[model samples]
Target: MNGDWLIRGRDGRLSVYQLSGDAVLCRSERGRGGAWTAPRTVGGEQKLHPVLGIGQGIDGYAHLVSWRPMTNGESGLVHSAHFRPHLGALDWNPVGHPRGQGRRTGAPAVAVDAQGRAHVFVPGEDGTVSLLAQKEKGGWEPWRELKGSSVQDCLAAATGESGRVELYATVPDGILHWRQQEPGAQPVLQEALQTQVRPGTLYALATSADSTTVFYTDVSGDLCAWRPGDEPAVVVASAGPGPVSAVRCDIDGHDCTLLAQRSASGRVAFAAYPTELESAGAWWTESGPQLSLDATVSLTTDDNGRVVAATSSPSTGQLLLTARKDEPGLALEAWRQV
Candidate 1:
């Protein structure tokens, strides 16, 4: 799993795309860190919100969904990349057959159910949630609308026991929305079981067959979690007043979600939460480096050990992508610019 971390961003200085990931191209290895090559611009002046999903093919095709900024007046897109046989050059092809153009909210959420099919949920025009699913044979289905205007900022997903993709989002009215998807069948949509909570962004992690752990920004701008059958508990006080991201990871034998957030002063921080019920919060490592908005942190394609965090510098407006490999029984290292 040793390879260079791919940094995909629009460099305002050069006004081009700096794409690097394939081993044969510029990557060293997964565990090591290094400098990136001088990227030759290939696109226009725009921002990209991309999520990577690994496939089940022999080559394990990596699927990417790039959600364009709403101000750019562009629609969401889909792309696929894979290494050729014998470690040949990388192949990044556009396989997007989109449905329509609309405003996109936060970064798109991706989840592969138990059936090995990838489901991409994107928030678009009027806070509508659209889905672009991969077919069984070898292609992508046209973009299909899922739900109407909601918050358009929060979308979290995980797969259930039957491999059904479950999505959670919060609307403007302080309602937490939940839905479960099965192919060819209508999604069962409903409001989450109410606790003493209000409007906020959410990140849901499937911990066990009967439980799901949620970390989110509460009404008072603090980071909190709602465990199974338990009241809402504080994870990080004064956490938000900004955006938050989380990814479920195992520490020792317990399930945990690593939550990251940008503070009001621009400093970023993270904390881990146990999957099962607990009254106490784990020790958080918040004295970390600074980060900007519209940043992203996600588990690498196929739920691999790699964790990638990409952010933009507020002052310089530079996009930075960094990564750390998460091995079981170990912790992630400090963030480094790729």
Candidate 2:
């Protein structure tokens, strides 16, 4: 794989490991990106939960979100840090705790618009969704509720040439809800549907490249996909015993592709649905390398079709970061670093 992606994970102990990378270099106590620098403690005294978000800002810098358990059992507090573009260092300017909102925490969600500003989505204690956007002057804007009711989960998608952002969240009641914010305009809900996706409930949400389709799962453990244009929801994969996480990638604009992994095993699997051509059926047979890794895994991608996947192995206590590219023969096995 020519394109390699990576992540840095800390287990709340004193050690921080740079995920698999091509650089093959390690330094002492590094945080905020560096060959090695001192790791900055952001999540306070508690163990930093992995339910955070990491992505590139419009300015081409890496940004991070780390949350900690708060006073209320239902709500958690979050913090933000921006890494200088391509500089192995993190900028700690707008740092602090989420305020003015009742204690609320769920899966942390993030999105960066055409501008470099970052937007973070958290479920509020009131059962409504809230948002936090970065300010030019340095400081987090007050939390703004984006939607009402508890969100099942959130997956962000950047759409159009302007790079407008849309956050897709599934409601506990089984409705897939979405909201889009274009720089200066007000954030509004797009649509909601009963969408009998899965019975077990949604564990994650991922969008296609164009932000047109939304893929989700139900409590019954089935994988289903729904888009604005598609009339009825389609089940892409049936349920397994435990929870399953899905990541959608645009193999090509002419087709739709998905990669899903089980929570317990950390084994990754793939599914494809073609639009330009007629396939065997609506859902293609599941295929691809079955990854057997030690750590629980999370997946992300870059613009160049490169994937960044992280696995924190409970067995070895090591966080493994791997990158795979959808090349001609098979997913290229390019090892960047470990």
Candidate 3:
């Protein structure tokens, strides 16, 4: 029910994961043109936190991560699950706390490299960033702390065209960035960039093979985008105080980026603009009915390349979805409950 609840598989099928009670439940499409199955439990025999971290690798598998609270009441442990479209999820595996101590302070953010190794990043209660990564041959390296301080729980990670992974975290003053020196290498901290970012509103989209642009709501509730080293962050539109979800797709043979978020008035808002051209401007269009102020919205491209947006109904808890119609401009089909 939190974090990114929607994902597209390598097979072009889409899957939605949500938190139900202490277990994680999933409803998935049979295939590109198939039907959706009923919701079923995919994780959580041990009690789990509501937050879920999901990342997809090049190999077409979705990696799920969550926190498992210990019975003794000490800091909980981190656990992970893996799933493919046809094959169901594997048993949840324990990924002990970073450095083997202290529960992660915020929802974990995961990024899988070109080699298909998943790297998990979590912010510590002490305001440090910790990383637990998969080894090439199979297995995990010890959890290590990446250089950071005064870090907020909201974090973002993505793999760029160079096949290296990059990470971003918000601090009291601005944002912190880190990137792999090379593919599969340990991520090294880059220069800290100063900007006023709202906590829990960071999202990263890989704009090109070598560059990734991070989007977030500023403290003033304006949506902004910044590609490290290219330019200062540009305001794209005004939005509510929540995380924004975006995906890049071809609209009428033109490359475009589509964004979705919960509006200040509680409706899901959609926007479209030329990719990397924030200065061109975008208009926010509210769609669907009002939702909980904290409800999360996710966007992904279907197999046919149509943009799909999804969010859970706060009142009924049913899944609601809408897709871009195959027409000129950014027209959408009616919202449908799944």
- The candidate that achieves the highest lDDT relative to the unseen native structure: 3
Candidate 1 stretches with Cα past 4 Å from truth are: 1-61, 67-76, 81-107, 147-151, 181-186, 193-200, 227-232, 249-254, 264-266, 291-337
In the range 1-338, model 3's lDDT, one tens digit per residue, is 32356888877888888776677878888767467888877753666777778887777678788887765655554555555665568767887887575544678888888888989988888898889899988889888899879998889988787778999989989888899988777899987778898878888888886788888788777788888886655656566777888889998898888888888898988888888888888889899888875467899888788888888743455788888887898888888778
TM-score of each: 0.63, 0.65, 0.94
List per-prediction Cα lDDT, in the order shown: 0.48, 0.45, 0.80
In Å, residue 253's CA in model 1 sits off its true spot by 5.1
Q: What is the Cα-based TM-score of model 3?
A: 0.94
Least well predicted 10-residue stretch by lDDT in candidate 3: 74-83
Question: What digit string (tens of lDDT, one per residue) describes model 1 on residues 82-145?
Answer: 3321122233344342345544444566665554566777665466676776776767777777
TM-score of 2: 0.65
lDDT of 2 by residue, 1-338 (tens): 00011333221111222322211111222333223343334322344444545544445544555454445553345444434322333322333344553343555566566666677766544456667777756666776766556554443433323565555665655554555655634357776766544432333332434545455566555555556545535455542433334444556454344444443233444344553121333432322233345333455454454544554443343444444556642253532223
Any idea how many clashes model 1 has?
Answer: 6
Query: What lDDT score is found at residue 31 in candidate 3?
Result: 64
Worst 10 contiguous positions by lDDT, candidate 1:
7-16
